[model samples]
Target chain A: MKMKLRNFIILIIAVTFVSGGLFAQKKLTGLEIMKKVYNRPSPKEMEAKLTMTLISSSGSKRVRTIKQFIKDFGKVEKKIMFFLAPADVRNTSFMNWSYDDPNKDDDQWIYLPALKKVKRISSDSKGDYFMGSDFTYDDLGDRNPEEDNHKILRMEKVNGLDCYVIESTPKDEDYMYSKTITWVVKDRWYGVKKDFYDEDGEYLKTLTLKKAENIKGYWIIVTVEMFNKQKNHKTIMHLSDIKIDTGIPSRMFTERMMKRGL
Target chain B: MKKRFFTLIISLILIIWFGFADGLQITGYVRNYDGVLLNDDMDFSIVQNTLDLNFSMQTSKVGFKVNPYIYQYSDKTTVFDVREAYLDLFFNSFDLRIGKQQIIWGKADGVFITDIISPKDLTEFLLRDFEEIRMGVTAVKFDYYIGDNTFELVWVPVFSATKFPEQGSIWAVTPQFPIQPQFDFSRKDIKPSIKNSEIFAKYSVFSSAIDFEIMGGYTWDADPVIHTLKQIDPFTHQLLSLTAIPEHHRLTVAGGSFSTTLGPVVIRGEGAYYWGKYFQSEDPMLKEGVVEKDYLNYLLGADFTIKGIKFSTQFIQQYILDYDNFIVNNEVNNLMTFLARKDLLSGDTLHLELFSYFGLTDEDGLIRPKISYDITDGVNILLGANIFFGDKGMFGRFNKNDMVYVKIKYSF
Candidate 1:
């Protein structure tokens, strides 16, 4: 009985040491976590391996694996590229045109190999499917934190880590959603949960990040699940073989890269 | 094979050029609609699986727009129908477009609606008219600024098609009378076409509290109607025909509108008056006598958006003076009144719409209620029904079997 008690006491001490040490390592509120994440210093250019999966009611499953590069060009434009899967679309070459707008909605375009043509699309259709993936054009576009009003709701322990819950509302009435709520990890600055509301202020959808594994010193979400509250439908995204800070070139995001098969 | 190779080479050149010196972009989408109505049998055949394709090509040197669209049904096919295709040239505060485009010139609700003298949907609702494309003669438009106000001048030295190209194509023409015979199709095409010229000025005043715009314009159309009698019979001289017009049509219009916010209320309203000869014309229904000139259309309405409820109403009169003429023949006038409100709920929304048309001729109206609910993320379900009462025959357009419709939409 004495030995068992000693073992239990040692286990408790180790648990306390770990938990207490984390709090001392960083004393941060939910809002502070959001601010830190927004201000993280990393490479201005990055190339990542991405895997996306689409699930439909008819038991249809589509899996896509691609290499994507992101480049920041001040405020004028933040360029993104799909080096692989854009051409892997039925195994044909593809190209896309997109721009970041300062005053109005951004524009997008896609060149289909089968059609043998380049098509222009309106900005209002940002919610449409992007290259047959679950992610839409709007989801791919960069969202500036300064453009929205943010309110930190509370803090909670989520998936063994403390996180901050915040709500963000856009000032523009023409925006697709009225408000968005997010739960971000306190230390990693990664958003793990998100809720989207429609223009009429109704809860429309929720996105949950399941795993954040450190791959090559980069904290990345390996799995994400998006559930359509009304449609009873769900989409899951999983990323594997991820590498960060691969010295991506700015030229890769240009229209030339899109035209030339990756 | 050569053509395909050429296309590939051109695409590559464009891509490389864009990458080297400011990117060139070509963007567009196809808008396809699958339409369904409550009364499935009432011939919702107007629009079926219509695909509207839009494309824009932009470069550092120039911007190009090409919209080749088609509306298809199970049995019918319509082609080409380019709404707008133009090259845009921008310099300083001025930009010029040469090709097919849309122009806005009026202020009245019906003038904002059905009375627009443009190639457009004939009976589109006021809010829905924003999608109409107006086709006119090649016009040179200049925009000038005086402080916070703007003045515009548009000159058209040639005539243009004011009616939609497809209007006369699928009209519910009256069956030919055995004794009189139907109007000849060839006669309507006879054109002594008139030139159109217009000038308009708008003053936009803005402050932190309110924003308002006042505008006025005058237009002269060289086409006017004249009554002439050709001796068909001396004793019973039936009015031979209205001659093809080539007379001066002068019009003057003025209007002002303001948008202001008071506490939680946002008020927006506009009113306008049209006065002059040839501004309004009567339907050629009377067999013998002269028709009366009247107000084209006038409207006054305001809306309130507070909390989560939106309420609005409008009072309108179309051809008020012609009401007596139609009343004599027991023809229903098109003057309409409206009141609508939408209530926002937590996961659903409720809407109520009411309409009433009052004139010397008869009574007619419609009332509709709709309810929509969000069942899950990115999915919505809607149910709505329309009620029609009053003169069962005159207002029977809405009474098309008193439809009840349900729609399910899932958007990503």
Candidate 2:
């Protein structure tokens, strides 16, 4: 009986040390982790040439070429994208000005060469697809972390790297997605993978970052893929010739520039 | 003069090709249309070949665009025309455009209310697309941007009138009274000179929730005034020496348009008030005098998309002020239009569209259905048909003009 009690006490002491060590390591809240991911260091301005390949369920493919530009203006960020190839959508351009305030919606406009006019468009519907792609317009912009309730589910290994598995649920019930599960690389604060759930809590899509590169001390996503489970379709985006801190002028994101086409 | 103009255009093209080769972009389409009339057994068929050329170049502060069109009809008629040629100068807060251009200012579809700056071509009536029917005008436009508002001013030195269909054509309006039908009639168009040039101004504001614009203009009426004079024929003793003279009169227009989104649907509306508009009386006796009246035209429309299908509908109304019951048959006119479009294939390479228009007061309507397929990049094939129904109205008059057409286009 004495020997048995001694062994039990030793086991308890080991458990206490392990638990104490884990507690002393300082566990991060989900919000804190996401804040770090959101505030990750990035270039003030950037330009990239992207090739988008859309794949159908039957394996048919269509390709599109685009040029993208982004500039930061203290409290606001401006982005402009122009279609360069694919005769059908050639010369079509889209511009957006995103504000820091979550209450202030983004200002968006589209320029259709056929109409020779620049039309201001509403961006209230966050669920709408962007350019027939799996990504929504909200996905292209910076989403405020405060808009969602985030919780750390556990720690897991993704691509042989330690990551934090987080589940985020939108505060607004009318949101397009009921919840999103993200796997963020622990040390680098990179979102390596994400799973999107529909309003019914059904798995709808999966997004994976296939490639990432570090340039001038800034990490950039070079290749990404989104697969829509419901539609059996997928879209792959490959970004190249990326230049950061290029001093892109704020005027480049104007309606006049949209009409001009890149 | 025609030869000189063609030579000048060719020279300009050559200059652009050599001087600004890197900045120049040449893109247009070559299309062939084969149409056959469904009602008449008289072989009412037509074939047309069209080639459009557009050249544009832009720098940081200045830009220029030139478009030339060439058309050949099956009737052995060929014509060359310049659609647009303009030079743009940009400033920090304002921009100026000089030369010939097309300016559109309305929110209605398949109707004209505030979109009056550009004249229209009625050669094929309403069979062609509205964008194709709009002809450019030579003018100088200055746009000033202040905050979220844009102020635009336009001045046109030369006057251009709308082109109407040829006489004895299927789309011609038949007259009520007939005398010596063989009598020749001449038309005189009163064109405003530089001294009486046209001027227009508009102020527009764009917001996150809605966009709105207000505009006013003093210009010549796009419609012509018909002045019928009768003379006695010495041989027939019949009032057969009739002459119809068409003239343009001065008019003023004030209009505004607003567009906003309500949930997933977009709502748009436009209204225009015309002062001193000429209208022909239905009664032959009253037609001798040109009647001038003020009228208001308005349109309301909504568009939305559901499951990749887009649907749009619009309601239009025209009200004439101070209407004389004896002279005017109807004081108010109403019309409605609906359009639907759907795209098939993963990349939306195949498109289908249906459009319909109805005249509520006249009880006449038209339905047009079209399908287009992209054979390859920069190439497309389309099949469409126009069906008209009614017995005593505008569309009713063209019931026999129903036609089916096939078009193939190659763009570069």
Per-model CA lDDT versus the true structure:
0.47, 0.77
What C-alpha lDDT does candidate 1 achieve relative to the native structure? 0.47
The docking quality of candidate 2, as DockQ, is 0.19
RMSD of each: 13.5, 9.4
Q: For every model in order, what is the iRMS? A: 14.5, 3.1
Tens-place lDDT digits, model 1, residues B107-162 = 23333521223334433221111343344334554554343234555544343433
* DockQ values, each candidate: 0.03, 0.19
Residues B1-412 of candidate 2 have per-residue lDDT tens digits of 9999999999999996788998888888899998888964734556889998888888878889898998798785697899789999989889899999888776677788988888888778877756578888999999898765789999988878888877777777765545543323344455457777899999987665677889999999987776566666778867755666677778999999988877667788999999999876644466454688999999999887766577889999999999986544468889999999886754566789999999898999899999998776668999998889988676878888888999999977
**What CAPRI grade goes to candidate 2?**
incorrect
Considering summed lDDT, which 10 consecutive residues are worst modelled in model 1 chain A? Answer: A1-10
How well does each candidate reproduce the native contacts, as fnat? 0.00, 0.13
